[model samples]
Target: MSHIVSIQTEIRDPVAIRSACDRLRLPEPVFGEVKLFSSSATGWAVQLPEWRYPVVCVVNAAKLAFDNFGGRWGDPKQLDRFQQIYAVQKATMEARKRGHSVIEQPLEDGSIKLTVNVGGAA
Candidate 1:
């Protein structure tokens, strides 16, 4: 049996955030109040490659706050990629905690496919 899931991502786990950053080879996220372009946010801040401001993940609120200045300060694709990887890492971790195994594949369309095996069985 198989299932398909579409996730509306909310960055809520700091451990998963660190995992995603490590997977992407980006900087480790820092927890504190971070300065944006004209405002400030408090959370785990992840700085993407070539981005001017960091993306702040308020875990308790499951929200992200950032200032890209309308794509001038950062490429939205980078942020999207981070979110995608974060979702994968988070899901894989949860599945493993429940004694399940995961297989991941990268698709041609820049998307990842994850298959979870129940009870560690293929």
Candidate 2:
């Protein structure tokens, strides 16, 4: 049996998403850019940035898993994880589309900092 693993990324801009995809050497059309906001004790906002092509990050990952693991990723749990990661990637991309720079470092805090700046600086 083959095992497949995909690293998570935080990017909220279409441009940034494209750059990341290139950096990761992943295929195109990772996802769409859209702002998602949820209100709670700690209000949180999420965004999924648009891609240059007609590709969804989630879908690409599924394909990659199948290619790497020989269909083992068909398992429901694996699919769920793929979807969750994809959602996060999309949200990150959206944030970048809104002119917010997302910087994620290895730390306990799951929060990512968005630096708003004029012009593109990714």
Candidate 3:
């Protein structure tokens, strides 16, 4: 049996966030108050590539605050990629935790295909 899952990503797990950052080769997230433009936010600060300010993720509230300056400060694609990879890493981790086996394939369209076998050997 198989299933298709659509995830609306809300970054709340610090471990998963770290895993995603590692997978993307980005800098580790720092937990503290960060300055974003003229404002400030407190959370785990993830520095996206070429971004002027780091994205602050309030894990407890499942919220993210950032100042992109309408793509001038950073490319939205980087954030999108981060979200996608984060979702994949989170799902894969949960599946494996339940003794499921997972296989990942990177599609040509830049999307990933994760095949999970439930109750299967790792």
**Number of the predicted model whose lDDT against the real structure is largest:** 1
RMSD (CA, Å), each prediction: 0.7, 15.2, 1.1
Error of 1 at 10 (Å): 1.0
Report the number of backbone clashes for model 1: 0
What is the Cα-based TM-score of model 1?
Answer: 0.97
Off by over 4 Å in 2: 1-73, 105-122
Show pairs that collide, candidate 3. none
> Across residues 4-92, which tens digit of lDDT does each residue of candidate 1 receive?
88888889999999999999999899999999989999999999999999999999999999999989999999999999999999999
C-alpha TM-score for every candidate: 0.97, 0.29, 0.95
lDDT of each: 0.96, 0.38, 0.93
The total of clashing pairs for model 3 equals 0
Better of 1 and 2 by TM-score: 1
Off by over 4 Å in 3: none
Ten residues in sequence with the least summed lDDT for candidate 1: 1-10
